[model samples]
Target: MSLLEVSDLRTYFYTEGGIVQAVDGVDFSVNAGETLGIVGESGAGKSVTVRSLLGLIDPPGTVVDGTITFDGQDLHSLTESELRREIRGSEISFVFQDPMSALNPVYTVGSQIAEVVEHHTDRTATEAWDRAVELLDDVGIPDAAVRADQYPHEFSGGMRQRVLIAMALSCNPKLIIADEPTTALDVTIQAQILDLFEEIQDRYNTGLIYVTHDLGVVREVCDRVAVMYLGEVVERGRYEDLFNDPKHPYTQMLMRSVVTPDRPVSSLDPIEGAMPSAVDPPSGCRFRTRCPVAIDDCSTIEPPDYAVTSDHAAACLLYDDDFAGDPPVLHERTTGGGRDE
Candidate 1:
């Protein structure tokens, strides 16, 4: 079984405007030792999905429906205390976007790391400190002994990220959810961090859910990729299949925009139009407004998932039953017929 299985997960925010369905009917699973990249635009629900798994959403936000099963146990069914003491850090860890905000500024980086070990395990302060230092060393931080004494501000953005990673690994979690982990770093540092994730996953056999808006990073670190549009996943396939041939309109548009070093400067084509608001996303297919091949029916009826191959699938009317010829056919049919009630 997969290490983490999320089915029909819906995260909604009860705002004054209305209910904002941040993550609607999302389903995916991450197997042990595998890396799954969730790629999308800034407001496409990638963060909300992972945050819900950790029960971080509160007050205005709620996991309205569905199940989040981690290691055969339903996370939503666990008590708050049970989740914090048994699930979080112990079985699952998170590497957030910005270490500056994630790590307590008042505390030294070493203490933050030590606290995780101390809280999760029956270790004394000194033992936890030693383990924290060892974890820092494992993630390639030099002079771990002295660096552990430094504050978060004392480290560079890259180094701070490394420290956060160390903290995430302090408990040797089976799964790690990294949400835009390299966003604040430079290109060189981003590459280094991605390499670190690959190395750690290989060595520790940890399941990873790497969430980012940057498709380039996804290509580098993911075994399989899922592309989300608005609040739903529109496309998913193996890395090679996704990059080489994207079936969904949104995924194809994303591929065209990737700033790969090998690509010609003129070949980079950015997808136009901002994502629709989650409070009232576009009717039918949420991505229809921006999709080039969007038909009248696309805005009217939600497209059913179509199998491009044995392992690859996409949600778009282009491959729906209305289209003639092949099972994996792509056609341009214009009609905005089915609108969500």
Candidate 2:
């Protein structure tokens, strides 16, 4: 069985304006030693979906439906106290986006990591401290023993991120949810952090759910990719297949926007129109308003995930054999003229 399986998950925010459907019927799974990249534009519900798995949704938001099974146990069945005691940190850890915000400025870096170890395991304080230093060293931090005693401000952005990673690995979790772990770091530091994640996953055989909008990072680290739009998974498949020949119009537009080495600067075509509001998204297919090949049925009948291959699926009406007119071609708009044929 998969290490983590999320089925028909729906998280909604009870806002003053209206109920914001942040995560609307999403489904995916992660296996041990595998890295699944959840890529989408902001407000696409990538972070919200992962948060729901751990029962981290706040007051305004609620996980209204669906099941989150982690390591064969249904997460929803566990009480808040039980989840905190047995599941969180001990089984499934999280490496948040910003270390500066996530880390306690008052406490030493080692103390924070040690706290988790002590809380989750029967380790003595001294043993937890020792383990903290060992974890820092494992994550490629220099002068681990000395640095562990230092505060968050003492370390650089990259070092701080490493510290957070070390803390996440403190209890030897089976699954690690890294929510944009490389955010705000320089390109060089980002590369280093990505490399560190690779090393950790390889060494520990931990399942990873990498949540990021950066397609470049996904290309470098992810084995499988899930593309989300308007809180729904528009396309999902092996990275190679999704990148090379995107089945969904949304995925195709996203790939066209990325600055790849092979694709020229002039070839970068941004998807026109903004994402529809999640509070009251477009009818039928959520992406129909922005889809280049959207047909009448796309606005009336919701298209289920169409199997393009054994493992590849796309939620687009065009994939249906009965789709009217010519098949939609992914084209790049040129500077001088119209879209390339």
Backbone clashes under 3 angstroms, per model: 11, 0
**C-alpha lDDT of residue 263 in model 2:** 67
Supply candidate 1's per-residue lDDT for 81: 88
Instruction: Give the per-residue Cα lDDT of candidate 2 at 36.
Output: 97
List candidate 2 segments past 4 Å from native.
Answer: 331-341
The models' CA-based lDDT, in order, is 0.87, 0.90
- TM-score for each predicted model, relative to the true structure: 0.93, 0.95
Best by lDDT: 2
Summing lDDT over every window of 10 consecutive residues in candidate 2, give the lowest-scoring window: 332-341
Q: How far is candidate 1 from the true structure (C-alpha RMSD, Å)?
A: 6.1
Locate the minimum summed-lDDT window of 10 residues in model 1: 332-341
RMSD of each: 6.1, 3.9
Candidate 1, after superposition: displacement of residue 275 in Å? 1.4
Stretches of candidate 1 above 4 Å error?
325-341
